[model samples]
Target: MLLGIFIAASSAGWAIAQGAALRVPDVPYEPTPHNVVAQMLRLAQVREGDVVYDLGCGDGRIVIAAVRERGTRGVCVDIDPQRIRESRANAAAAAVAERIRFLEQDLFTTEIREATVVMLFLWPEVNLKLRPKLWRELRPGTRVVSYVHDMGDWKPQRTMTVQGRYGPRPLYLWTIGSAPDR
Candidate 1:
């Protein structure tokens, strides 16, 4: 009976044991350049009273910077435990750990309804797959920003090119419920 239960849970994409991820991450860990992070914050117009959520947060730089620079609270969600640990350490080093919460779990399953701004640095397909969840969970007027990828068929309200480690990378911004039909 226990083995059957385990099989059922695993088939549904649940982690088989503690410390394991519910599923493999959609992309590898790649830190966004500091310049791009700054631009993301600027483009998002992050400010006090805002609750920022960095989906698939790597090293927690985005959330850390948001909390430190804008006095906003943040949530860092990553499937990788290592990334979560790194994010926590980085947040502590930046002295903004109290303002940031780290969740070591799948970004797909993380609750983001409280966020006023959502940051994404994931792959194109991942962004596409995550679009509906963002649209459904986030409140109206919430800002969604993506680096290096754009959500398909959902036009961004604003787009800008920012210099990244590899050269110019595109940043996209969309306000939930403000755009026309997808």
Candidate 2:
């Protein structure tokens, strides 16, 4: 009976493993340039005194821009220690170090409960994994802005296509209300 139970447990564990969702590997990090930053800011509608959070914040460009240009406070999160160091340097260089906090953490584990605006540049799978977290934490009117990717099964409140130095860039904006009709 014990041997049979062990076999059944092993089979069940294997089945659960097969049913688990897998996160795609991290994408190559790229900074949003100044022109793209402008469009994101426009779409996010960030105002002074608002707190912004940037998940997978690569090089701290978005956080730096938010604090420096919009007079808002920001939290910048990145899993890579090297990227965190780079973001610190970038924030200091931009003279917004006092207003932005750089955190070295996995994006899936970081908390943005106090944020009034959230920025994202992650892949679709990462976004999907984070959707429920955002819905649970963000206040009803808080804004979410994404670059290059959209949350599957959620419709954006606003969409903009801006012509940047590299080419046209797509920006998506959503609020933390009901999930958009799939």
Candidate 3:
């Protein structure tokens, strides 16, 4: 009876997931808030010509900001096709469409080795699972910035409290090779 209930729940979830490709209940879309974007960008330390990758980039605000403000090229990855479309539109509106690429792909499986800077605003568990990948894939000098969450077992090189119009936000910055144990 327990096994039957488990299967029923699993089937229901799959059906719901298929019905909502743009957003699953557990995976609601959260666009980067303006204040958080400012904080994360600062933490990213993005420079001209930098290749920035934003995992789970909802609406592409961070990628668009990077290209527009810092002269950086960016790749924005999200599992939702709707988000990819939104990001592309946002980039075009920001006039950084040519500098940013929006991709609909799993963040974990995507290649980020070429990134000079990577940004994320994801669940803590997601970051934790991605820790080893970041360490293994990113170059020594690569900069990683996270909004509201920290990479597991990896201590940030710098942290800042960003006060915004809405509220106070904490941004964490990490460098790949500097503190492996963090």
Q: Which candidate is the best by lDDT?
A: 1
* Candidate 2 residue spans exceeding 4 A from truth: 1-25, 164-166, 178-182
> For residues 79-136, could you state the per-residue lDDT of candidate 3 as single tens digits?
8877888899989888889988777888878999899999987888888988889988
Estimated TM-score for each candidate? 0.87, 0.81, 0.82
Off by over 4 Å in 1: 1-22, 178-180
Q: Write the per-residue lDDT of candidate 2 for residues 90-132, one digit (tens) a residue.
A: 8988888989888878777887889999999888888898988
Provide the overall lDDT of each model, using Cα atoms, as 2-decimal numbers.
Answer: 0.92, 0.83, 0.82
Candidate 1 structure quality by residue, lDDT tens digits, 1-182: 99999889786654445555656789999999998999999999999999999999989999999999999999999998878989999999999999998998888889999999999999999999999999888888999999999999999999999998888889999999844356
Clashing pairs in 2: none
> Who is ahead in lDDT, 1 or 2?
1
For residue 72, model 1's alpha carbon misses the true position, in angstroms, by 0.1
- Cα displacement (angstroms), candidate 1, residue 181, comes to 2.4
Q: Worst ten-residue run, lDDT, model 1?
A: 13-22
Better of 1 and 2 by TM-score: 1
